[model samples]
Target: MEAKKVALVMVDISGYTHFIRAQKVSAIHAEEIVFELLEAVIDRAEYPLTLNKLEGDAVFLYAEIGDNNLARVTRDVAKQVQGFFEAFYDRARTLTEERAECGCDACSRVHDLRLKVLLHSGEAVFRQIRQFEELAGEDVIAIHRLLKNDIPAREYILMTDAFHNLAGNLAGMAYTPSQQTYPDLGTLQIHVFQPSN
Candidate 1:
């Protein structure tokens, strides 16, 4: 492994903390549901994605050595990520509708369920070290910046240009625009979160 060819993932569920603070059951329910959905995707996919852990209503993940490269765009990675978000988002939408029908007091306040997915290509792997994951470089930093400073307020599946560049010749991907400006951080693009119909 010259450099760990991985897709650094940082996905978050909106209103996670607020739900946790207001109701334990809702928070727990939210976590379980989200985790289950994520876990299923990771499990079913043949790509190199893994479940790092479930933190609050957020799931930290990473996809390892798939079709990511710097030749063209992340045709494979983008499609997989977009598909995952759409699937989960669709399910999340169903969950929201169900809550209204169930009239569950705890879940009533959850007006929306959205995810922010950040995928980065970098060098390093964290495998049962019981120690830590090394991400001390520009690649990791750029990803953080994309998620924190670049992505829109309410968007889903925003990927770094680094990932897209690796798509190689594959085409047909619709991503949103990035609000933050980071010209030095390679090609940064944000897919304006849309659930697949």
Candidate 2:
């Protein structure tokens, strides 16, 4: 089968469960608020958003914003991700500094979510099964590892080499070393944004 171009992204928050664990209110309520905030962020972006499976504090997302030239498709995906991270960070920061303008769900839970965005692009088999987006094989697996190994808890965006190579704005952005293990591939290297800690 011929391979299709796709980017597999994984978004998750740091200190999410810990925040709920220490909360006086119900954990479900706290989690629900975070989930709602995440949903709104994705919805506002208008990027193809699909939730596959939730992994603890993490949320799996598959975004396909229509197809364009393969190169442009990948770069745009990175830009879209970068933009989303900035927007989310701004929202969270405003809430933290007590400058939040809205009293909505996002503002309320803004302090609870610190998002880590990971992007990995490669060839894949994309099949729309009913209301689901199912992508399988090494491409999918590779992207998952890219997200897992590259993105740190506090860092905003981590892009695999394939993604960085195609992303338009690389020269100005900082890059840091990222190494990880894959099922059969053993050790691999990628790039991650340096946390300005």
Candidate 3:
């Protein structure tokens, strides 16, 4: 089987569990907020980047490198990332105002949620099982391992060096070099880009 290069993106909600537990929010209300936020992110995704699946408080997206130029792909991914955050913050504000008088725990704390993204570009083996398309390879494992990083910021985009090398310098963005050791994946260098609101 021929291996193909693909970009992997994961948009995850931080403070989800802590918010629920600390606020003592109901499961139903928590689920509603999470679902709504995840849906907003999904709605912002553009072509070439397909939604792989929804993983709890995160959305997994993947796009085949194909013949598209790196500049075009980078711009597209950056746009999608920007769009998701814009929609996410907008929705949070709207929910906050709508529930200002409700006094419900979930409604009162919806704005506490934060968004972060993990990006990596590498080779993968694609397999189609029933209705789902899955990407499998060491790269896939590496991207997931990035989620367990010790970044100080709550909201930031962390990209693997491989991705940064291809995406180049994103406009209006500054990246800080960082590294973390994963028990299984060893030590990997990463770049963190924190977008200003």
Candidate 4:
């Protein structure tokens, strides 16, 4: 098997666990809200990027680094990231407002949802089983490890140092340094970019 250069991304809904617990919403209604938002983000995905899997409240996506122009690839990934958030927040606002008069807890509190993205670029091995395509390698682990961090902002995008080196400048986005240690991955340095309202 050959290693392929790819950009890995994870879009996760923040405040989901806390929101469901605090609102005391029923499982059926809670799932409905979650699935709807997840679908909205999935629907906004563009070419070169494909949805790998849905891990509960997060959607994992991957795209091969086909373009030699590193800057273009980074910018495109940033654009897709921005598009997902736009769709997510817009749909959330609409749903919350639409159900404002409703008595259901899930419907009324839908506005509490937020989104965060974790991105990294590295070599990964693609594996296929049955009808599904999956990515496996250190890069996959690196992106998932990013999900747990001490970043104060609930809604922000975090990129690994490798990704930052290639796409950070092209993104025209500002980020702050974040460092965290994982048992297996050692001390990982990341860049945090908080999206503006």
Candidate 5:
């Protein structure tokens, strides 16, 4: 199949490593909490934007960009990104209240968990072999590589120049200029939108 232009996104649970590294008895509850948080984020995904796969503490998603739906899909995804954060925190808050009686490390530390989103626009070649589907390309690698960066924050929305151009105003959100450098990819110009909280 021919490669297609698409918007790639990843919603990651920050501070998950520390939260999940509890004792064996508490690990089960930690996993359950992570599962709940992940479910909340996944539930916010809408049409045009599909779940490509789950990467441990993160969800990888993509939306194809075509002439007919370019504007609509970009706008829809931009709004959907915002919705992910809202759903995540709302669910987290509810979980915190419900689990307050419990003294497990995972339950007590729910507030430490944060959400980070990464958006990149690029071309990808998608393939399916039986039930297993995979996306491969330089862009795909770049988006995944972005997960490990010097962002200096646990929660924020980071978008590549390509994605920022397509996503437009992003509901009139303000973003600051930032850059990430890798040995191979060099420097990537990114725009970061951080919550006021």
Candidate 6:
């Protein structure tokens, strides 16, 4: 399909590598817990925000922007991004309580798993390869690259300036302006929002 403006989102589990490595003996339970958390986030995704794929510890999603639905789409994506935190943490809390008696490292340390979301708006070309739909473009690369930022928070929402312009102030969030520079992608100005528990 032709390139079109799309809002991209990724909900990633923080400290995932450490958690898996630290709980090798309980790897099955750890994987199961991660799957549950991902399901919670996926359940919270509404229309317009389509699940592109599950990237191990992260969920890659995208919503196409139409000329007449820019405002509505932005609002929906923003709300969905915010809701992901609640969905993930709520499931985490329930798992922790349910497995409280279990001494497995995965059960005991579920609290360490945090969710971080990245948002970006840009152009992308969509293609269907048999059963899989793929999004390809510079924006897609940029959004994925954003997952490796130096944000000092365990859980937070990071949005590119392009997305900020489309979504406005995101209802109640007060974003802190920040910048990230990659050797290849150059500089990216971003807004960070760390939600309160």
**lDDT tens digits, residue span 1-197, model 2:** 33566667777676676677665554555665566556545654544445655666566665543346656666666666666666666656654556355444434555666777777776667667787656777757876666545343566577777666666444456777677777786776567774332
- Best of the candidates, TM-score: 6
Which pairs, if any, clash in model 3? none
* Backbone clashes, candidate 2: 0
Clashes of each: 12, 0, 0, 0, 0, 0
CA-lDDT, candidates in order: 0.56, 0.62, 0.83, 0.84, 0.87, 0.91
List candidate 2 stretches off by more than 4 Å: 1-3, 47-59, 62-68, 90-112, 128-130, 150-153, 168-172, 195-197
Sort by TM-score, best first: what order? 6, 5, 3, 4, 2, 1
Each candidate structure's TM-score, on Cα atoms with residue i matched to residue i, is: 0.66, 0.72, 0.92, 0.92, 0.94, 0.96
Clashing pairs in 2: none
How are the candidates ranked when ordered by lDDT, highest leading? 6, 5, 4, 3, 2, 1
User: Which residue ranges in model 1 land beyond 4 Å of their true spot?
Assistant: 1-3, 22-25, 40-44, 66-73, 93-102, 109-111, 125-128, 131-138, 168-197
Q: lDDT for model 2, please.
A: 0.62
The C-alpha stretches of model 4 lying farther than 4 A from their native spots are 23-25, 169-174
Question: How would you encode candidate 5's per-residue C-alpha lDDT over 43-125 as one tens digit per residue?
Answer: 98988889999889999999999967766777788889988989999999999999999988888888899999999988999
Judging by TM-score, tell me the better candidate of 4 and 6.
6
Candidate 4 positional error at 180, Å: 1.9
| RMSD of every prediction | 4.6, 4.7, 1.8, 1.8, 1.5, 1.1
lDDT of 6 by residue, 85-185 (tens): 88998999999999999999999999999999999998899988999999998999999999999989888899899888888776677679999998889
Per-residue alpha-carbon lDDT of candidate 4 for residues 47-123, written as tens digits (9 for 90 to 100): 77888999999999988886586667766887889788889988898888777787877887787789999889988
lDDT, candidate 1, equals: 0.56
